[model samples]
Target: MSDIKIYSGSSQVRVMEIKNILENEGIEYQEVNKMDSSYAGIFGEIQLFVSEADAEKAIQLVETIKNK
Candidate 1:
């Protein structure tokens, strides 16, 4: 049961939106904050991962949200 990365970006708002979407759809996810603590909001990307079994559906959900 490997995890597949479904989204990665520097926008906190967008990241939160994606997390909500995934939650609403009952998709489990793992989030990784890769930002430099010193720079915080100004640097790095937030990554979201889902199980490989759910990767396709998770990606489609993410894309739909992003297109809005």
Candidate 2:
């Protein structure tokens, strides 16, 4: 199994914000988008994932951004 963790979801801007935080903190991550197709038009959720070892650190960086 893969040792990846999901840190956040929704909107591209939100995902990018979290990504920036992680990068500033020297943490590595991967972004995954789950797209949905429907009559209402296409939409998707953005997921930010990091290695298990960096999960805690990534979460912390996101939290810091949240608290600011």
Reference-based TM-score of each model: 0.92, 0.70
| Candidate 2 ranges beyond 4 A from true positions | 37-42
**Which whole-number lDDT from 0 to 100 does residue 48 have in model 1?**
98
Cα error of candidate 2 at position 9, Å: 2.0
Residues 1-68 of candidate 1 have per-residue lDDT tens digits of 89999999888899999999899989999999998889978889899999999999999998898888
| lDDT (Cα, tens digit) per residue for candidate 2, span 1-68 | 35576554556666788888778778888876674645212466667888888877777777887788
The reply for model 1, stretches above 4 Å from the true place, is none
Identify the candidate with maximal TM-score: 1
TM-score of 2: 0.70
Q: Which ten residues in a row have the lowest lDDT in candidate 2?
A: 35-44
RMSD of every prediction: 0.9, 3.1
